[model samples]
Target: MAEPRPRVWVSQPLIDAVIEPLRAQVELITTDEVTAWTAEQLAARLADVDGAIITLNERVGAAQVAGATRLQVIANVGVGYNNLDVEALSAAGIVASNTPDVLTETTADLGFALLMAAARRITESERWLREGQWGQWSFQTMLGADIHGSTLGILGMGRIGQGIARRGAHGFGMRVLYHNRSRLPEAAEGEVGAQYADFDTLLAQSDHLVLVLPYTASSHHIIDAAALAKMKPTATLVNIARGGIVDELALADALATGRLAAAGLDVYEGEPAVRPELLALHNIVLTPHIGSASLATRKAMVQLAADNLLAALNVDGAAARMPSAINAEAAFAARTASGDKSKKR
Candidate 1:
């Protein structure tokens, strides 16, 4: 008998172009609402699907995936898959893929934008102008830090971090310094004119600092009151990374006191629900996590995820390339093994 068409659950609606390719090989149950799906809803939606395409909004942990008996893969559109518990997914013999390279440059662009906005007081100045405060111009009115010929510090040195370093070093004539879990090789550092700095040095020396690290237990609150205290009083801080990396309460305190110059945050610890302390601060710029929000980049991310989903599900003649699976080996093992069909890997 012919194999039955795979049933897939799409967490959110995608543009027609991104979704069309999968229409022929998969039966899709897609949600039209942009709102995030609750745990119960996810359990119900994913119960019988062979695969799923999810976004950051969906939090899939052990409990969430407990009932996903038929689920073979979960493709995420964004580079970060913290939303989906990889350990749980791998244990379930389910392949989980994320779109990474496609959104690297786009996210880097936002990181730089946030850096400049925080350094130059762009958002604050705009609010001032809109409030009709532009009537008088003084020598020091709205004066802010300069990006050119300044030190640029990055907390994480991944692809996105490297892109930001290149822009700062080559385009702005800034000294780029990065601190990662492990230092990059000399050649890689030379490519971006970046130097490896210890965490404390990166905080103290940078005239403008940006956080681009992943969200992990170790990384959570890596930037706290003490870290903020190490920074120069006039330095600006920007976080394009996850919110939990920085203690939001400590950050707001720093910005409120004259200890730090200003801050720009694209992601918040609570997410979608920012701390009221941050909102009350005037020297900060807040964005609702639009790092990869560009029209073209978003489209590309969706397309890449769709392609990976197809490849992972092995739709007939779908190229069958392994998706950007975090646990590709385990997934392949699952495919090859005929015995021990337990949910956990």
Candidate 2:
């Protein structure tokens, strides 16, 4: 008799090119609709699968995984896994992994694009011209801040942050400043041509500030009205990080009252739903969290996630090759403890 193939659930349809490998080897369950899932909905689906490939939209926590007795692994399709309760997964002896390197450059490119677009009022001008409001050309009509020779401040100095720093320093003639929990070493600073700044200094000194920090308890609403008050009134703000990192209501007030200049945002708190106040502002540019949305990059992310799922499931051809597991130690420790108890029994 043949052994039963492991079942894998896909939260949503993935890139067509990356689905073939998964289809050939696993008993697959998948969804075509981009429907939002409540924790209950996700738990219901995960209860019977050995593993699952999911996106950030699915918030998988302790309660959500309570019914998932057979689940062993979760493969997140994006670099940020803030939506996942990793501690809960670790306690369940479930290994959770993410796709990181594949999206770094793509996300960084989008970050810089948003920075420049907001700084120079590109989208606003386009709207102005389209509205037949370009009848008169004045010297200062659409005058905007210059990217060249500006001071660029990055709030988080990870791989994507380093890429943005390189673009600002090497591609353009901008002075790059960065603030992380700890400063990068001198060697790394030189490679990116970036200087270290304290948080308050980063806020005050930068001509344009970008947020790229991961979402965490300490980082939620890190940028609030109080923080925004420290920024230059003429400076621009860009957030390609998670939405919870910035207080959206405070941001709206700042932009509406001219407390800050212009702004750009890719992610939002409770996303796919924008605050009506932000939508009313013409000085802000909003994107639907597509920092890693390039066709090639999206494909790479799905493939990497599939590889992680395969390895974590102990699937053939992917043996002993766990890639990008965030809580590998915890998962392994729990597994070992389970084995020890089983041997005694």
Candidate 3:
């Protein structure tokens, strides 16, 4: 008898062209509709599968993997992997991967678009006009901030951050300032035309502030009421990073009371369910987390994820072969220590 083919579960409906090839070599189980899977549902699906291709919506941790003895890999469709407990996945000998570089430029484009929209009050002006309020044009009808020759502050200067910096410095002729855990090398900084600044300095000097930092225990609520107090009342804020970094209530208060000029947010703490306070405000621009929503970029993300899943599942020396495996080394170490050499691919 032939050995059973590896079982792989796809947690959401992905592009058919990107996913169809997997059926040739694996027993592919897929979800047609989007699902907010419960923890129990996650564990149950993982229990019998050898691998899974999941999106940001699925949160997996120790409990989800406790019974997933056969599970070997998880390929996350997005760059951010906060949805997965990487430590737990590594300890359980499961390699995890994500699509990163492919979406960098696209996400950066959206971030800058949001920054321009909020700073210029583009969306707000359109909404007012649509409400038939633009009876006549006046010089000060919708006076908004200027983009060029302004100071642009960016937090968390990674690839996307660098992209934003380049756009601000070279394209918009803006003064670019960035704050990160460590300063970028002189050459990299020069290339992006950005200067390093302390946290407070970045906050105080910026005409437009963009948050592109990762979400972690230390980063959570980093931009709370106190931080907001430090920013210029005329400054515009844009968050293309995770939502948990800002306090929604405090942010709403700032916009409502004119403590800050305006804010553009793509991600929210409880996403798809924005705070009512934010919804009621007109100064803030809200988007449904479409940072990398372009067709080409989304397809690339799915393709990269599929490539990672297949490589980690069927390729010889799977760990080293995965394109963007996050915890392959640690996962392989755990497997080796457990005397699971027979299962090592």
List CA RMSD, all candidates: 2.2, 2.2, 1.6
Reference-based lDDT, each prediction = 0.87, 0.90, 0.93
Backbone-clash count (model 1): 2
Model 1 stretches with alpha carbons more than 4 Å out: 317-319, 332-345
- Residue-by-residue lDDT tens digits, candidate 3, 22-113: 88878899999988899999999999988999999999999999999999999999999989999999999999999999999999999999
lDDT of 1 by residue, 92-160 (tens): 778899998888999999999988888899999999999998878799999899999999999999999
Task: Report the C-alpha lDDT of model 2 over 129-168, residue by residue, as the tens digit.
Answer: 9999898778889878999999999999999999999999
What overall lDDT, based on C-alpha atoms, would model 3 receive against the true structure?
0.93
Report the alpha-carbon TM-score of model 1 versus the true structure: 0.95
Rank by lDDT (best first): 3, 2, 1
Q: Whose TM-score is higher: candidate 1's or candidate 2's?
A: 2
Q: What is the lDDT of residue 289 in candidate 2?
A: 98
